[model samples]
Target chain A: MVDVRYETAFTLYPYARSADQDADSPARHPVVIVGGGPVGMGMALELGLKDVPCVVLDDHDGVGVGSRAICFAKRTLEICDRMGAADPMVDLGVVWNVGRVFRDERQIYDFNLLPEEGHKRPAFINLQQPYFEKFLVERIRAAQAEGAPIEIRGKNRVLSTESYDDHVALEIDTPEGPYKIEADYLVACDGARSAVRSMLGHDFTGRVFEDNFLICDVKMTADFPTERWFWFDPPFNRGQSVLLHKQPDDIWRIDFQLGWDIDRKAVVQPEYYMPKVQAMLGEGVEFEPEWVSVYTFQCMSMDEYRHGRVFFAGDSAHQVSPFGARGCNGGIQDVDNLGWKLAAVIKGEAGERLLDTYQEERKHGADENILNSSRTTDFMTPKTEIAKLFRESVLDLVEHTDAMRPLVNSGRLSLPCVYDGSSLNGADDAILPQRTRVGATLADAPTDQGWLIDRIGGRFQLFTVNTDFKPEGLNLDLVDVIVAPDDLITERYLGAAEQAVYLIRPDQVIAARWVNPTAADVTAALNTAMGG
Target chain B: MEKLFTANIDDADGFYAELLAAHEGLSEAESYALNARLVLLLSNVVGDRAVLTRAFELAKQAG
Candidate 1:
């Protein structure tokens, strides 16, 4: 059994007695999110902001120990930005866009992830997972103070769950005792080894890699540039790969690929891994070990995200290898996708069938993340001899030629998922850029009224550019932009067309777009977007 | 999208001889590595994904 009461540095939500403990019947909540990790907290914050009542039950009081998921992608940052929690994260994160790939101590090539300009957020920022969760909780508190119907019950772990036709009943175990509660919707934002998933008897079916990776967060004052350094095979760790990244504070995160067989217990000790860290940092480097963990990853996901009223999000829904930093990033995206849909369903703005689109769209996203992560894993730890031979050949070719550099697979960094061929998507204008097409998360650009994304509040919007064509009888917010001829917004949203109209979803995903769309077209698209 | 079966190589026999000659003095492992590298290099040359996919399917079928 997994230990739910793991100690952490911060106690953001210590257990407290609630009135529900003495209630005659179970308290009914609009949404009950299990596991107060980033996704759950983000879900609560999203629902709370939408005036949807939610209760979060977490086993632990606060953020977990260690700088677990260090890389927050631009898309994740944008999602957090919409939740009013991105400012502190970006302010304290170690921003980086360049990554260098090396093979056997020789630098092959360096890559710039975000080569284009006009984006408000950088390509990625390395922040500790604890701080990320803390910021979400902080935002949750801020929202709660603003009369948002959100409650977090710490030390209240769900022991069992029973799904019914109308609602899902949960039996939670707290420090005091056990209590019963019912929710219109139950979201399992629990981690990969989700107890709720076990209670529900759902299994994640995917390939589990035999290789184990040792993650070490070292605290030291080093002058290493804030860039992701990946070594395929180095002298210190011969025949193995190593990844080094700079996190906030004086902490540096290093991942060492340990072969299939290892003493899991002994390897995490300071004596076993510190020498390896010393060797990698050279002879005279002074450092202190912060957190050490050995983990074997699996590229896995549940077959479905929504099971009746009980939904699965984050690591509970799907899990990818840590190579591409897709774990928590993808989880946050799940929260972003499901949040508005759940809120709309609760508020009677959308039909219950709208929730099924969450399964359709996010399952597609999970597959995409799994495909990229599995490819990276296979390239990193080639199970077959032929695969290893090709991987080595690619590394060899990178030394002398620029053509082979793109083939190097350290990790294809996380990018936003565009839901192509989604059921929720509507009419697409072929004249517009493919990047901002229907079902795509709207690309950010600088506009006259601050950043374009900042102006896209969490609501259905009729986003227009260089046009005054407003659809009649539609009660939607307008993100009207009158920009210069060469504005970045125009370049991103309006390609060959002189003017464009886009129906944007609450989660900032484009539902439909047109060059000259009538009101009936907008109504049809909106209806389709809302699961009509 | 050109089909993989298209006879595009001007000197098929010469190309076959050249390919084998590239791995003339290599050990078993080295020959395997060479073949892998050649596959990668040629795959880049045939950058069209549709053609590459068809080539993969045809090669798999032959085996």
Candidate 2:
């Protein structure tokens, strides 16, 4: 059990004294979310923005306990921007791009993620997980205050769920009492140890890494640079790897590799961790231990994320090692993918078959994250002598040669997952550059109205570059026509062509492209894109 | 198709030592890049598609 006595740094939202009751008995909602965590709140906010009603049920009354998931990638930041929460997150986060790797005391190579910046958000930001959840909750509250139909019930646990053909019946347990509610669709964003998933007996398949890591969040006034620092087999931590990341409020997160086969609970205590931390930071450097936890990495996922009217997102659907910062970042992408589809279905804008595409697309995303994370973990903690030798050779070679820079893998970090073989993808007959490919995420560019992403957001966009073509006798209500007259936009999108057009999905993924598309061509593509 | 460059160098040990020495001070990336350049150069020198294909298949099998 978590220590309830531990005073949280952020606001501990009070559990409502009353239970959620139905005035007409067994309340019905458009959507019911089982967890009120970051992913759940993200889904709520995403749906709320689309004017879809949703109720979020969580057993906890506060945000995350520890400073978990410190790294938020640029793609995640962009998604948050759309949700009306990125500006404060960017402002509060420690923006960074440079990452350095070292073997013993010798530095291998340092890399810059974003050498050039025409985009709005930075490459990466390091904010504590509590703050990320807090910001999402705030967005939900602001929306609710403005009369948006998003309700978050704290200390309300979902005891069981009954899935039907068209709706789901949920038996929820609250502090007050137990109540039953029905939802058009049920989303389980509960967590890694998901109750819903276990209740359903879904098989989570993957490899569990043998190495354990002890994460220590320390608050200190140190002059460490705001770049990711990774050390392999350092003198202080013999035959182990160490990672250092700076969070907000002078709090630094340090992870030390504690080889498997130790008491996990014992290693998390300050007695076992402080000695090693002191050896690295020196005894003179004053510091206070904020939080400590021991964790073993696992790369696992379910075969399917959707089961009839019930859907799983975030940790419920999949999990990856924390090395690549893919866990929470990829979860946010799941919300981005599912939010629009769920809302569209609820609003009767699209067929229920559209929801199946969520499982198909995000399964691809989960696989990609798992593959990359597993590879990074293998490199970081090699299992055999031969593997260690190869790692050592690669690290040694990265020290002096610029050509070997790409070979150094501390962590590849997180990038947006492009829905490359997705069923939603339409035909691409236009001869275009690789960046503007049909299945790729829309490349952001500078425009008169802030940024390119800001303009084409939360809607099916018919983006035309250096061209004036209009769709006639078609339902244009579902699509927004965006005209980019900027030279950079034309250069990046149209290349040397006089005009080009692209059908962009609500999540800002290019569905199809045309050199000179007619109304008939766009209508057929959009029909396929809508899963018609 | 045949073992075209079969243990052709008389001082094989010396050549191996020199090869290792050449990569001693270089970074892992640099050594790999150098090896890639060397492979391209040697491939060009062979100037035969079938020989290059055979060399690739043999190297892969050995690996």
Candidate 3:
């Protein structure tokens, strides 16, 4: 039986020149996103929620073909919630945090990602990329129905792109014919093979992993626990690493490392893969295949995500090996970091120079992802004899000793990027708990009315935990003042001090914190955060 | 319960290459001593006498 949920046909928004533009003139927009994937749709939603209108162009009408990007980290889900798509995604996806690693026949160790309570979202969720794209589109549509000026044009492709000092222009290919569109800023959210990046002649540089992996999604009924399982050299698939993860609809994603010597074409055939599957599941277990593909991963990205008026996001901007679910999760964060800054600049709230922080922060994030993914790739597929010795030694040691367990790198997994040295962050005058610190994403704590995140939704916020200090004279419109009286909030934000105030960015990153703050201090921090 | 043996090395070719390289210029007698020294170092790290005995017995049984 075919799973209809896997096939998503996105509704196409009609393409036409606006009423203000004639046949000889091009339609100009504040922002133009050149991909309809998760990143592009998310960027549009972020801008739309902030009252910015943008056009999203895509060559396809639906979500991705296969069950791609199945792991969504908590940070990504929180960002989606901010962009108005998290509930549907979390409700439909399998929420899981446990992962197990094995060598040959014995399971070495397991991990529980989020052992603490009182958080809004889970550690991670397993949902296919298609569902992710579908939910994001629904969010954009719902906002559009409520008069959010966001438009998505499917079956529209960007044939070429040109950048100018003030704006960027694009040549589009549509079913109706060729048209031109100009934008104050153009974002490339297209997938790995971004036509926009290609036309701009930008170099996406990094290392290419030599090994190929076979990815197969199969619909099966089994009692396997909902945890990530990775094996170094499984008995069934000897001399190759295998990863097994459970997705929604009883579909399981299995990846087998096919070394460079194998016939790439033959490995994908069901005839060749069936025996391996049988060996893995044991003889009589029944299952049906859903999707299959062979892929070689490359950890590469553009040196600079921002080039003049054009910007790149998602796989178009960076690609990591599928081992860690960093590829799409990282893309979500890219849009999250760019969204508020772009919105602020467009609304004349922040200077154009504020846009430069997007590069400073997200490029740091991309480099971190690339570093982690590359190290994981190297450990997984040792290229040298010395590398193999150390890998086996570590694996063998892990089977016996708990000390070596942490060294085992089965995709380090994804975490939020910390902008410790970002120019936008303000100094911490008071010492809080390690969990809540400047340059880190705001730690979620439970409150009486709702979670702290729920109250501090998508705005510049000043949170005062349990302190009744009121601002005497200041521009209160610049920051939303939250007096959190809950004990949990006090412990998280105010450890030893009786009162503390935090200046948070619109993206919920803690910009600054103070023990006893004056209006001048808060105002200075707000200005610095806004690139004043 | 005794710890069961599992297949640890995914790529035997890489493992064998390393194994060969470890004995590159050593004499046969010196290589045998190397094995013994490696076992002693591993045993110290393994720490459990019963577990080490069990592993040795299993290695011999496999042979």
Candidate 4:
């Protein structure tokens, strides 16, 4: 709700002037991240945890309302915990594990993200983005109090940016006026239409979905499953699919499908929407629609995440269908991946060439996510009439065939991305873990429940059994050896001891591994990846 | 086939209720073990094994 009385009361709430006319060195930050969205704030928190100096820019006056991108995967929560924001976030959000799909107003199927053998956080959490951003901003403030340089410029738009050999120069347009800022590197986390990326002429290429979608945020005053309830078909809505999720404080989120033919503007009305809501839910349930928006998704990814010292992340990098809640979560993973690398390069721990691999590996993952979403999106929007009949045929078999259950439910949509080829990743132990590599599960990598995320610790661990020896060419700082077991092996890894020697990268993907391995094999893997 | 991941969520309340029913014999070791598996699963979802490994070890030690 826009308070026009209060908003008009304060006509111009401008930013503070650069009070230090005599302060030397305008390069106040090692890295300046553009766009203060989740990805940007994520990058800021990652850098802040590492005691890295950075400034985050956003043109928004405050964290906007309407609850965008509420579903976050488990990996995102881990990163939030690393930044000391997960507890509050988890407290503020709802832990959702079950989803029920409806067909013609009958409960068709129900799937649980059933807690697996190993998972600390819940499968997903439903929290509005504004509160989420507030959590991160608070963490940024706490980091600033500790003397870690983190300046957040509200209403600061990047007018013009020019990157030199050693630094990035950005002209930020504050309310007072425009001012120039310099930094060692620039990380752009701007949303879909990124001005920074546009200025740099970076091409974002991918397929665009033809169907339009209406996202609705509402206060449900009725009885509905507290889980993520969806309807492939509701009787009142005829053919349009509905994606419903419960938000914080009795609010429910509904993403209504508007086919290629519907008018974008005219479709939003109490007459049109109320029927859709009453269709899935019986007549008595009432809801006050908080925010209604019309949007269409594009399956696109940026060709590059970096140009010289300037970097692109989040929506600026790639986009996917909200089907699996991968877009925002994957973007946060990018920040986790780039945060350490950016900090390391700035601290001179590795060459600047290491920065190039960010585009390579992350872009690859981004494409994978888009493809995954596209597959689901295609399944959702049956193009041919025959295909629609086939989908119906499949849904028909859900109760009859055990083999068909996996087909109908598709179980969990979250799959760990495999890093194929990148300088940072050596590429032997890709399948060693279940999910995101740069996150928390890497064996033998360094970690503390402190500021530096799971990614910031260890020089990649080469988990090897010392018995099967081989030569390794030395002098590479990125390689750390973890002897399989000096009596503490079996309890450490449930995987067989022969599968030892998993070389974990700094981002924590199993870079390479040798079974019953040797020193030479480890060295070769490190040499191939580290170029040492 | 050994289940890489398992969910007793099939019967929702029954599963957790069963765990609560067995609370009399539940040891601290069992609790830690549960926490470890949970941490490991969550870490895998997030795709960070470093924390997974740490939590895994801590769970075993506590056990």
Which numbered prediction scores highest in TM-score against the true structure?
1
lDDT of 1: 0.87
| lDDT ranking from best candidate downward | 1, 3, 2, 4
Model 1 clash pairs? none
Residues A95-193, model 3: lDDT tens digits: 767888888898888878774677898878899888898888888889999999998876677777889998888877766677787899999998788
Worst 10 residues of 2 chain A by lDDT: A1-10
Off by over 4 Å in 1: A1-4, B1-63
True contacts kept of 1: 0.00
C-alpha positional error of residue A485 in candidate 2 after TM-score superposition, expressed in Å? 11
Candidate 4, residue A468: Cα displacement in angstroms equals: 15
TM-score of each: 0.90, 0.87, 0.87, 0.76
Model 1, position B49, has a per-residue lDDT of 89
Candidate 1 chain B weakest lDDT stretch, 10 residues: B11-20
1 or 4, which is superior by TM-score? 1
Candidate 4 structure quality by residue, lDDT tens digits, A1-532 = 1122112112122345564222454544688888777888889888877778877777765566668788877778876876777887888888877878777767876777676533446656888887777788777778778887777766777888888888888877766666677888889898788888889888888888889888778888677768877776676666768777888888888888778888777767777777776665667777788877888878877777888888888888888877887888889889867887777777777677777877877887787787667666765776554445445655664433333344443213554466654565443443333332322244322212322234333355544433434345554333223333332333343234444455655555556664554567666676555433
Question: Candidate 2: where are CA atoms >4 Å away?
Answer: A1-13, A17-24, A475-487, B1-63
TM-score attained by model 2: 0.87
Which runs of model 4 end up more than 4 angstroms from their true locations? A1-14, A19-28, A409-412, A427-494, A498-503, A514-532, B1-63
Interface RMSD over true interface Cα atoms for each candidate: 14.5, 15.4, 10.1, 17.1
